[model samples]
Target: MNFELFIARGILSKDKNNFSRPIVRISIISISLGLAVMILSLAITTGFKDAISQKVIGFGSHIKITSFDLNKSFESSPVDMQQPFYPSLADSTGIRHIQVFATKSGLVKSEDQIQGIVMKGIWSDFDRSFFAKNIVEGDLITIDPEKRTNDILISKRIADKLEFNL
Candidate 1:
């Protein structure tokens, strides 16, 4: 037998009760635990990234077309839906669909408290599938082309703070 093989066999023999035996067992266990932890961390990080990405895309679409103004605020400048590019965007390659939306920053006042909020306005053509999966309590709002409605949807956090519910 080779010198390395002979030495390795002597070190790993079951009859030996030397310091190296405990050290070898501990090293194997430590390596196994480290690998397990790494795998778990990777899985958790991937799931967290996917969840956060879905929430962000749910709040706003993948792409937004707005006026090229220099205004620095959460509210975006309005874009005309009658633009020539608006229709072509839906038919373009790698594009799934197009939607028109608007946002306005405002304040909501309760009997004893006032809170700032940004209101997002969507039309009938806006896709509600993303939100349908996330509605915690009530149904989605219905918009009529011939009439205006006073219905609004609020998050649970905001509802608790403003003392509002369905």
Candidate 2:
């Protein structure tokens, strides 16, 4: 029994191309297929993870600065962009760039079409790269601190319903 066990282990571990038994060849083929399947699965899962993460984080940043209020919804008061802690916060480890943003609920009306929409106000400092990558239609709005732009991006569903010209 010991000899047989040693022989079986040696057969599997040998680097030679000539396999003595059909069972050993079958086992090697099975292992190769299993490894290929595992690699394919890993690649597919990683791709999906990256895509979902981009979509989720594209809407908001990892850290948010907001007012301390009981109102949990988006109706909370805005936080002052110029804060005393900004200097320390920027110097802190793991901290990167900071951008000021605001939001207000409003209705967009055009002729006979009226739609309730959440107007997101972003400054020139706001990162547009994320939106540029994930945007399905139209181009990313070029924002300038010195100048204002009329460029607006809306969803196709809204555009279709509103009968938008551009």
- Report the number of the highest-TM-score candidate: 1
lDDT values, one for every candidate: 0.86, 0.79
Error of 2 at 134 (Å): 4.0
Tens digits of per-residue lDDT, candidate 2, 52-159, equal 887777777778888898986666697776788977887888866678877777777878999988767888887777777767766788787798877777767777
Candidate 1 Cα deviation (angstroms), residue 142: 0.3
Backbone clashes (count) for model 2: 0
Give the true-structure RMSD of model 1. 2.9
**In model 1, what lDDT does residue 49 have?**
100
Output the worst ten-in-a-row residue range by lDDT, candidate 1. 79-88
Q: Which candidate comes out best when scored by lDDT?
A: 1
For 1-166, candidate 1 gives per-residue lDDT tens digits of: 9998898788878888887888877887999999999999999999999999999988887888788888989797778779877777888899876877889999988898788999988888878888899989899999887898877888888888998766
Q: Which pairs clash inside model 1?
A: none
Question: What's the lDDT for residue 98 in model 1?
Answer: 80
